[model samples]
Target chain A: MQWEIVIGLETHVQLSTRSKIFSGASIAFGAEPNTQACEIDVALPGVLPVLNARAVEKAVRFGLAVDATVNRRSVFARKNYFYPDLPKGYQISQYEIPIVERGSLEIVLGERSKTVRLTRAHLEEDAGKSLHEDFHGMSGIDLNRAGTPLLEIVSEPDLRSAAEAVAYGKTLHALVRWLDICDGNMQEGSFRMDANVSVRPAGTTDFGTRCEIKNLNSFRFLERAIEYEARRQIDVLEEGGTIRQETRLYDPQRDETRTMRSKEDAHDYRYFPDPDLLPLEIGADSLHSIAQSMPELPGAMRNRFVATFGLTPYDASLLTTSREFAHYYESACAGLSGTTPKLVANWMTGALAARLNESGCDITQSKVAPEQLRALIGRVADGTLSGAMAREVFEALWAGEGEVDAIIERRGLRQISDSSELDRLTDQVLAQNAAQVADYRAGKAKAFNALVGQVMKVSKGKANPQQVSEILRRKLALPGYFLPGA
Target chain B: MALAIDDVRRVAQLARLRIEDAQAAPMLAELNTILHLIGEMQAVDTSGVEPMSHPRDVAQRLRADEITEPDRRAALLALAPRAEAGLYLVPKVIE
Candidate 1:
């Protein structure tokens, strides 16, 4: 029997704000344990929480970017829980009224596009960190991150496989960074995801037992965690064991998930509207202003690349996947007359990407200037240099050398387009391989490829391969003195 | 809306509490009382009402892509029960 894997993701993006959500304390990571914590963050007596205006603005921007409904009024509730990391004893979050509702994200899965519906995105304060090490059998709490603002984006269970989940996560990652709302840095815990995975029989109406996998910080880990959990659940059900609804932690080292606890319902948190803060209210003018300020998102950018630049859907998708990469590509293509975008994309994807990967640098930090890259592409288009020679010039430019013209002149790497020179090289190749020439005359057509290889080698790979192939075919069709079968 | 004895025990275990089995009966009654009050929120119709995620309506206030140092090293260390060489020391589990 076929099994269907159903997955949803809850992504927590820490807003890149200068201060805490409800307090003026600096929202800086890696601060000493409790130094950044103020009385409000620690939930002291008689301390009332003040909402941060910048944090709310960030949430509004995300809502506008996704074309979701931004509520004019919302309320913060105290999620009552007991933990060492939570200094406030209860976390202030939205339980009933969320900020953004019914947003959709478009993700490309293989050759087809699918839309993943967002259930809601709400703003909440992050809990503090717990240090289990260093203390003698006692855990310590660091409140530096206690009041940091987080935007929890929840998606509906529209994803059907692990690959789709990864695609959704990556698209969300790109969207957040492009909007400049969050840093989307997985390594620094700026962006993280918790995957809720369940499986049932294909086409079944009933849902299977769901498991929440926590703390997946990278796309690779998100895919692996979901895949492993799906298999584990399927095996358990097949073996006549009941699937328990639980929260599990993904162990990246083991590449597996372990049960953390059984899932909790909303009633378990004992939620109530927080009296320390006032109800949030916004006017229409503010929402309109935010919507106007929204930049070109990844979807719009991809379509523009395809339409204006004449790039294929796949090439456009790759170029616009990251904001930095897209900016670099457009800057490189600027002011280059008669250079097709397809050509520029080829060079960027082929030589530039390889160099960036080798140097462990991003597109912004690359040594090759956008203008110099354009010049190299111009050389290829004008036939002054072959594609093979352009690669060599690109390598030199990536190594912080001189410009394209200087590199070509210094290395004598100009293409051999002169027919006289090419003809001499071709004849020399045919004479040297007399046996192959005889075989060709005897109708062994495959033997003619040896002559083309010889001609390219003689020219030191500077010869235009297309021209060489054309001249070889012309010569091979002529009546030869060594025509044996004829 | 009150919690049952088994519900209290289950929630306690989910929270990683080492509660005694004998205390389950009393904790269940207390949890039930809390739930009964919270159940009042369900009476209000939330249809077509948008949920609130944050307090403000502003969007897209990004920090400059520059590094800012967080200068609370001393205060953070003060919360550690044990610290040496700017590192928190934990019990050794492996040799």
Candidate 2:
């Protein structure tokens, strides 16, 4: 029987707040061990945890971007657990009521778009990192990440397949980065996801028991883990075995999900409202101000790029992957005299994107400035440089060579568009290849192309291909062509 | 209301508290008395009354995002049972 895969994601977005959520300690990553942990972070006695204004504002901003309801008042609950990294016996999180609720995000897969419903986005403090290696048999606890602000975004099980799950994750990742709320750096552990996957008979409305896969940081891992988990569940059910509703960890090395320690199953979080902190209240004024502060969301900007710049939806989506990239494209397209946005986009998503991926650099770190790219594209449009020659100029520009015009002049890479020059080259090509010329006259169509190739070759790739083709067609079509070179 | 010896033992285990067999009886009796009092209070709940999260009727005050704490790795690590390389070392926890 065919089975349908169902998936839900819980993404933890590390806010870009300068300080810890509850304390004044710096939350900067890669700090020396426990230096960033302060009294409140380490759960010192008599210390009170205070909320961060910036963190709340960011959560509200996210809610607005997704058109979600921003709760006016939310409570902080204590999730009691024991771990070496958790200095506090309990984690402060929003349980019953979160700051943002009932939002939806749109994810695009190929030509189709689907909306993934978001259950809630809550405010919580991140636990410290546990370094398992080194120090003999003992584990080292680094509290530098402790108390860092996180917005745990929980989504409904609306994703049907692993591909949909990946698309949803990528869309959410782009959204967070576009809003400037989270850096969305998966390698840095700033953003991570937990996927709940299950499989049931196709066309069945009833849901299947799902096993939670914890801590999939990268998109590739998310896809692979969900696919493997879904297959595992389907196999178990087909063999008349029950799937245990337990938390499992994805072993990317083995490409499988394994059961985590049963300690996770025995977790009685004993969630209760923390008496130490009062309910978090967001006023109407603050909400309105945060809404105003939110930048144009990715979806809106993508639509604008399609309508305003006359770009394809896919091209627009690619360009708007990040706010910086969209800005770069806009800057390059501004005041463009002859080039179309489509041409600029092609170079960006095709050539420039490849270069950026090769060097592991982002658009902001590109050596070729927007103005330089615009100049290069303009040369191609104005017939000053052929498409191939323009690419060479682009490579030189990327390599920190001189300006576009200077490079073209220095390398003699300009397209020979002069009619006289192109005519002379075409005559020389026809005269040198009498056998091919006679074949063209005798009704062989391909020989005509061979003649044009010779013209381009004689011009050392500087001749305008379109002009050479036109001249060759005109001369070869006429009867009785004498061999001048002979 | 009453409590079993097993319940008391399980609670102690969950709390990570070491309770001897002799103390289990007294702890169970004391916990049963507290539960009896709580059972009496549960009978008097008004349906319209909202559940109170905190005793005080005040909203939380938010602090501005700023780094005012200095690095105190040395002082803090000195208080731990064991520390090395500016990290608190404890029994290895795999899960």
Candidate 3:
């Protein structure tokens, strides 16, 4: 029987503000545990939570980027629950009316794109960390992370497959980084995802029961957890069992999802408006300022790469994965003479990307300057260097060697593109390998490539393969040439 | 809605309060009296009235994003019943 997977993601993006959402405490990660927790963070008596303006600004910036409705007035609510990590016994969040609503993110699946509709993006305070190990038989509570502002971006159940869900997640990660709102660091728990996964029989509109998978921090885990949970649900149904609507935890080590233990009333978070904080109101002036401060979002920049550089959507999408990467490509494309943007893209995504990965260097830390890359691409385009020779020059450039022209001149790696030089070389190769030439004249197509390889060997690997093939094709078909079989 | 003795016991348990069996009936009656007052208030026609989250009409004041708090870990840890290695120790809690 065929089954379809349905997934929706709730991503918590920790805003990059310096201070916590409610208090004046530092929200920097990796601090000594509980050192950053202030009196307000610990929920001392007579302390009130004052909303952070920069957090609101960043949230509105995101809302504007996604063309969502920025609610002018939104209220903070107290999500009441009991946990040692939650010093207040409640989490301050936005309910009923969030700060941003009805946003959509366009996720590219292979060649086609799908718009994942966002239910809402709410502002909330993150809970503290609970370290379960290494404290005898007791738990350790570090309230340092408490009250850090988070924008909980919730999406509708639009993803159909694990791959699609991963694509959506990666797209969202790139976007938050592009906006400079979140650092998009999964290891530090700056951005975390909770996936709602379920499966139904193919061609059914009735939604199946979904189990919420909590805290899948990595995209790989998100995909794997969803796939495993879907299979588990399908198995249960096939065995005449029903899936329970509850929260589950994904164990990455075991690669399985297990139901989280909760008291019967634990899920009932009796949310009410937080009486301490009044309604948060964003004025028109503030919204305008935030809109003006908005950066060129990833989607817009991707489209511009396509429209301006004539790149394929796929290439554009890959290039615009990060703002810095797109900037690097543009800087290289600037004042390009003989080469096209497509060629620059090939070199960037092909050679440069591989080298960067191998060396564990970011695009910003690239040793080869953008202008140097443009020059190298120009040599390839003008036939001054074959692809192989250009790669050699690229390596030299990457190694802090001199400019493209000087490297080519010093190494004598220029392609033998001159017609006469290639002709003489091809003639020398053809005469030396008359048996292969005879094979070629006898309609053996494989012999042609062997002949070109011989010419390249004669040219010391500098012969342009395209020119060698052309010269060899013309010479092999000559009427006056002797054909051994004929 | 009126509260039953079982409902009182459940609420007390949720709040982590200890109440004897003899106290349950009086607690239910008192909770029901408060609920009756709230129910009477709910019966009033306030259809056009906006749900007031706070009594005052003032919006929340925004705070500038700056770290004004200093490291008081030592002083704060002194207040906890059991703290070691800069972390507050509690009863073992598992997910």
Q: Write the per-residue lDDT of candidate 3 for residues A299-406, one digit (tens) a residue.
A: 898889878888888889999999899999989999763338899999899999999999999899999888999888888888898888889999999999999999
* lDDT string, candidate 1, A396-424, tens digits: 98887899999999999899999999988
Q: Candidate 2, residue A269: CA error in Å? A: 0.9
Which residue runs does candidate 1 get wrong by more than 4 Å?
Answer: A264-267, A335-339, A481-486, B1-95
Better of 1 and 3 by TM-score: 3
TM-score of each: 0.86, 0.92, 0.96
Ordered from best to worst lDDT, the candidate numbers read 2, 3, 1
* Candidate 3 residue spans exceeding 4 A from truth: A262-266, A337-339, A484-486, B1-5
Worst ten-residue run, lDDT, model 3 chain A?
A261-270
Residue A399 of model 2, lDDT score: 98
Give the winner by DockQ: 3
Relative to the true structure, candidate 2 reaches a TM of: 0.92
Pairs clashing in candidate 3?
none
- DockQ for each model: 0.13, 0.79, 0.85
